[model samples]
Target: MARSTTDSSSSGSSSSSSSSSSSSSSSSSGSSSSSGCHFHYVIGDKIDKYVITKYLCSGTFGMVLEVIDEQGIPYAVKVIRLIFRS
Candidate 1:
């Protein structure tokens, strides 16, 4: 991510020299938001790229997808209930 550097020494404050604090902030006046499936516990694409390895189980009952978690850990994802449908 590209960042714009601004001089804040003119204010004469103790935090004027904090580099790390200013880098992550947006200097421009803009709006930012995330578009994801808000209903589900699944964090969507932003949660460290959870790769769907396979299904743990599947039948007329429901389905369970085995996935690699954020830390590359394995987990069983079973659809216990239908929270929302569309």
Candidate 2:
């Protein structure tokens, strides 16, 4: 699996040496979001080097699919569902 990084720092905060209290809250929210799915990729879609083949199952949080790599090696891919604020 590949990893992505998110920087929580804002542009205005970098100008001054004094850090804002919201910075900590922003970072915490960023970390929480990191655990959730950021994209809704479908079957036959290629993520990185893995190609989604078939859906295996689904749960409250996400769905699991069968996938393969360029070498045809099989793998199980879990895609997380996005939660929208109402």
Candidate 2 TM-score versus the reference:
0.48
Which stretches in model 1 have alpha-carbon errors above 4 Å? 1-49, 80-86
Q: What C-alpha lDDT does candidate 2 achieve relative to the native structure?
A: 0.46
lDDT of 2 by residue, 1-86 (tens): 23211211112222232232223221211122444545545557776676656555446775545556687656555556678988
Pairs of residues clashing in candidate 1: none
Model 1 per-residue lDDT tens digits across residues 1-86: 01111210111221332322333322221111221112133323222345444433334434443445456544444444333557
Residue runs of model 2 more than 4 Å from their true location after superposition: 1-42
lDDT of 1 at 59: 41
